[model samples]
Structure formats: C-alpha cells, structure tokens
Target: MIQIANRTISLATEPFVIAEMSGNHNNSLERALEIVDAAAETGAHALKIQTYTAETITIRSDRPEFRIEDEGSLWSGRTLFNLYEEACLPWDWHKAIFDRCAEHGMIGFSTPFDDTAVAHLESLNVPCYKIASFEIVDLPLIRLVARTGKPMIMSTGMADIGEIHQAVQTARSNGCGQIILLKCTSSYPAMPGDSNILTIPHLRELFETEVGISDHTMGTGVSVAAVALGATVIEKHFTLDRAAGGVDSKFSLEPDEFKRLVEDSAQAHASLGRIQYGQLANEKTSKLHRRSLYVVEDVEEGTIASSSNIRSIRPGNGLEPAYWDLIIGRKFAKDVKAGYPLSIDHFF
Candidate 1:
C-alpha cells in the first residue's frame, strides 16, 4: 500500500487512476479548471499538470540542436524552444488550478522538468511530483525533485533497465522512498503493440517499488490492460477536445474517452483478485450444468447396465462422468427410469 494525500492506494486491490492534463488546456486557465472538473466527474483519483517555463526547459536559441527535425514526428520542423514555449503552462495558473482541484476534492500534482520547476512546485506544497520520461536520464534533476521528500512518480519511456535502476537509486538516496515507475512509450501517439504491458510487473520486481503506466496510446485499451497487469497507477494525457489544437491534443484523450479509461481501469483492477483456481461463489450455481452420468432409459431390475442405458448428460446431480466405464458393465440393482441420476445405490 502507498499513501498519497493520506489516501491508501492499494495496488493489490485496485489501480490509482490519474488524468494527465498535460498542455491539453491550450493555455486557458478556464479550460484547465474545467478539465479538473471533468476528471473528477469520471471518478479519477488524481489530476496531473506539467510545471515548466520554456526558458527553464529549453534555450531560446534557434540552433539545429534545439530543433525537432524528425520528419515523421508530430511536431516535426519545430524547434524545441518554440515547442516548449507553446506547450508550457504559465506559473500563475497553478494556484487557481490547485484551488479548483481542492474545491472538488481531487489530488492535484505536477511533473517538473528542471530544478527550478521542482522548487516552484514545492512552494505550492504539492502532494507529490512526477518526472517525465524524457527526464529519466537527468540524474541531477531526479535528485533535486527527490530531495523534496514527497512521493515521486517517474515515467520509464525510452529508458533501459540500467537507467531505470540508477534513477530509482538516485531518488531513494535523496530521501524519496515512496516512488512509482510508470512504463511508458515516448512516442507522440504510441501503438498498442509497442506497449509491453508485462513490463508493469517486471518493473515492480526489478525495483521493488510500485509500478504503473504513462499511456500515450490512441485509446483506452493499453491503459485498461495495464491495470490488469498490476499497475498501481495510470496516467494519460487528457483534453477537453482534441480538435482544439494544443501541442499534445492530437495524442491526448477527449473528456468522454478519458471517462471511459477511468471507469475501465478501475474495473480491470477490481477484477484482478487473489489467485483462485477452484469453483468460485458464482460458479457454484452453474455447476449443475456440468456433465454427469445419468440413466438414459427405463430398465428392469437386475438388468445389466450398458452403453444404451446410461449416458453422460447435464444437470449434474449424479455420478461423475469419470465413472462411465466403471458403471457400464454393472448390473442394475433396481428399476431405473429415464432421466434418473446415476448413483452407486442403483448399481449392483
């Protein structure tokens, strides 16, 4: 069990669902508050925001190194500085958004990209901090965020096993013991095939910490599947409308889709009870439908039971089907009617 905001999050029982309002607000404070309300309505346990100014996240230089030049990328041809400029949330909006979350009783947290961003969030007394996948390799930044002594959630996208190990070590060394690693694919719009959901449990074993998923997949399939695989937390970018054209809007989920993700992730987690093999409570009633040995026709007393007289059928109030061969050549002790349940008492 992990405690966040005084609430016990039981990974063994159910997942902690989070709605990532990452640059999905389109720079509107009003929309950010509305997103919080929408997330709360969907029964989400927490709402997340990204904290960083463009100047802090990237340099304003238009150099080739600062530009995203991948042709297949969503934000291709745009410089990192320009991209961050448009995507960055103004620092002033944090208080109103946090206030709105408080009014609605939702946990508001943020992902900090740099040391300065961490300080800003610390001043706000945020319950926890999230480390984006791109920052997983930033050990110094991880140490800075971890020094705050709050619970930390890190996304493991594009990170190898060694890197993840180091990041977890850095946080623990810096006094952040409560940490969760989110299995993520760093692509803009991730594909289901690329999301190795089995990693959720593997990460838990590798680090001995809580594991989750930072889903960027187009739909809720991957997110819901992650819950079934022992994901303690789930974070997905959310927007009021994808058509509104925010930096992450194309890959983010709309309000209705996000609601479904929240509801389905909880359902998936609830369905994963302790390992059970035998007939369950609900299965007991359906046991009668199982096949069992039954008398197929009327027979006179002392008659030899044969294949024609007994058969395996439904309504399982008879000898087990495994006894069919044992009873086939036996003598009938009494007259047996058709549809009668076969039992030892009826055999000689």
Candidate 2:
C-alpha cells in the first residue's frame, strides 16, 4: 500500500482518483483555485498540476522537430516551446494551489518536468511526484525525483518495455520505493480502442508494484473499466468548463463528469471483490427462492413416491434437487400436503 498524505492507496482500497488540472486553469489563478474547489467537491482524493516553464521544458527553436506538424494533434502548427509556455502554471502560484488543495482535504502534487522543477516541488514539501509520459525516458529526471524519497507515479505513454524497465530501475536504485506505473496512451483525446487497459495487471505482475491509468479518453467509461482490470489509481484531466477553452480543455472532463468518474470508478473497484464462489452474505437469504425437491402434490402414508407427487420447485425448503432420483421409488413415511416442503422425515 502507498500512503499519499493521510490516505492509503492500494488494491484493497477504492481507486485513488486524481483531478489533473493540467493547463485547465486557463492561465488565471482565480480560475485555478476554482478548479481545486470543484475537484474537492467531486470527492477526488488528490489534485495534480504540472511544474515547468517553457524554458525548463524545451528550447526556443523553429526546427521541424520542435514544431508539432500532425494535423490531428490539438496544438497542431504550434512550436513545442510556445505550447509549453501557454500551458504551464506559474511557479509562484504553486503555494496558493497547494494550500487550497489542503484546505479542501486533497493531496496536492505536481509532475516535475526537469531537475529544477523537482527542487522547487521539494521546497514546497509536496507529498509525492509524478513523471509525465514524455519524460519516462529521462532517467536523469527520474533519478532526481526518486532521490527526494517521495512516492513517484510514472506514465508509460510512448515508452516500450525496455524504457519502462529502465525508469523503474532508476527510481528504485535512487531512493523511491513507492512507485506506481500508469498505463497511458499519449495521444490527446485518446480513443478507447488504443487505451489497452489490460496492461494494468501485467504492469503490476512485471514490476511488483501498483499500476493504474492516466486516462485521456473523452469520458469516464475507460477509467471505470481500468479499475475493474486492477487499476489502483486513476488520473484524468479536469476543468471547470471545457467550453471556456484552455490548453487541454478540449479533452478534459468537466466538474460533473469528473464527479461521475470518481463515483463510477469506485463502484467498478468494489465490484472486483475476489475470486469467489458460493453464496455471499447478501445472497444467502435469496437461496430459498431457488429450485429444490418439493412435495408438489399431496401424498398419504405408504404412498409410492413418483414424479407426479414430488418435483423440483421454488422456495427451497426441501431436499436438494440432487436427491430427486434417489427419492423417486421411495415410499411416503407420513401424509403430506400439496404445498408442503419435502424432507427425509416425510419419505422412507
């Protein structure tokens, strides 16, 4: 089990829901605080923000590689540096955001994109750190965050098995032992078909650590399905109003949608009780409604038992259905009514 703030996150507990306010603040501090309030109201366990500036995340260059050329991308035609600048939360605003989260009883943390961002988050005494999907290959950054000895969550978006293994190894070797690997599809507004949530369980088995999903899908269906497949944490982008338009507003969930995600994901986790069979506590009382051997017709003493006199029926208060063949040729020990339940004392 991993403890974030005062809450324990594990397979034994409800999925830890995180409201990721990544670039959804619309670059307004007031709106950012409002988003925190909305998230807390939705009963989310934690709130996450990104900690990086354009300078810290990328270089100012017009090179083809530095520009997003994919027309399908949300920020198509924008340079990576400019996109980061527009999306980044101001470092000075971190304290207010964290304090607001605490006031609302939520654990506040950030995804650090660079070593300097890690140092800044450490100064704030944040409870944990998240490694964004694109940085899973940045072993140096992983080591830097791990050395802080805080629990770390890494998103495996574009990473292959070798890259994920290296990142996990680096973190453990440094100092962080509480690590969570999130199954992430890097595409913004990602399609459910590409989610591949089945990886959640495989990741846990392979790494011997908790696994979850950083869902970018348009709705909560994917997140809820992830929990059923053994996800212990669920992180989704959140916004107060998508129509207001922020960097990630196109894909982020609104407040009501986020609330549903929290509620539905918990229900999904609860449904995964265990590898169980037989009657449960709630089901025990309903067993009486099941079919069993019953005296369907009246029978007098010394009467021959036959299919016409006894049969499997509902309101189980008779011998089990398995005994039907055995009682077929037996004689009645006593008189029985048409509605009476059959028992050993009524048959010889």
Among the numbered candidates, top lDDT falls to: 2
C-alpha lDDT of residue 251 in model 1: 87
Please list the residue runs of candidate 1 whose C-alpha ends up more than 4 Å from where it truly belongs after superposition. none
**Judged by TM-score, which candidate is best?**
2
Model 1, 1-348: lDDT tens per residue?
Answer: 678895566576567878888878887888889999998888778899999988888788878998898887899999998888888889999989888888888899899988778888888999998999999999999999888898999999999999999999999999998999999999989889999999999998889998899998898999898887888898988888888889898988887888888888878877887788988888988978999988998998999988888889898889999988889888988998999999999977
- What 10-residue stretch in candidate 1 is worst by lDDT? 6-15
Q: For every candidate structure, what is the RMSD over all alpha carbons to the true structure, in angstroms?
A: 1.7, 1.2
Q: Give one digit per residue, the lDDT tens place, for model 2 in 1-348.
A: 898789888999999999999999878999999999999999999999999999998899999999999999999999999999999999999999999999998999999998889989999999999999999999999999999898999999999999999999999999999999999999999999999999999999999888999999999999999998889999999999999998899999998999999999988988888899888899988988898888878889999999998889998877898988888999998989998888888877
What are the models' TM-scores?
A: 0.94, 0.97
TM-score of 2: 0.97
What C-alpha lDDT does candidate 1 achieve relative to the native structure? 0.88
Residue-level error in angstroms, candidate 1, position 205: 1.4
CA lDDT of each prediction against the hidden true structure: 0.88, 0.93
